[model samples]
Target: MSKRTTPVVAGEKAGSKRTKAEEPGIRILGPEEFAVLVADLLPTT
Candidate 1:
């Protein structure tokens, strides 16, 4: 029988810190803004 080894997953390290450039941008949209954005994608039928 062969020995089985566990594989390490990416981004599973403890206490990992991301640099400014590596961080993702977050945006907070108002109710009106969100509705407008959704309306643009939806078809008018």
Candidate 2:
């Protein structure tokens, strides 16, 4: 049987302080804005 995994990474401790999307530093982009940011990552002919 496989062992269960955790959401915390090695450098990060569980239940540590985290930034929320509502915070001023965090910017929530719309679909159009997100698409523009990742457009270069998509494959092209």
- Which one is best on TM-score? 1
The residue ranges of model 1 lying beyond 4 angstroms of the native Cα positions read 1-25
Once fitted onto the true fold, the runs of candidate 2 whose alpha carbons sit more than 4 angstroms away are 1-20
Could you give candidate 1's per-residue lDDT for residues 1-45 as a string of tens digits?
112322212232322332221234323344567677779999999
TM-scores of the models, in the order given: 0.42, 0.40
For each candidate, what is the lDDT? Answer: 0.40, 0.40
Clashing pairs counted in every model: 0, 0
> How many backbone overlaps does candidate 1 show?
0
- Model 1 earns a TM-score of 0.42
Clashing pairs in 2: none
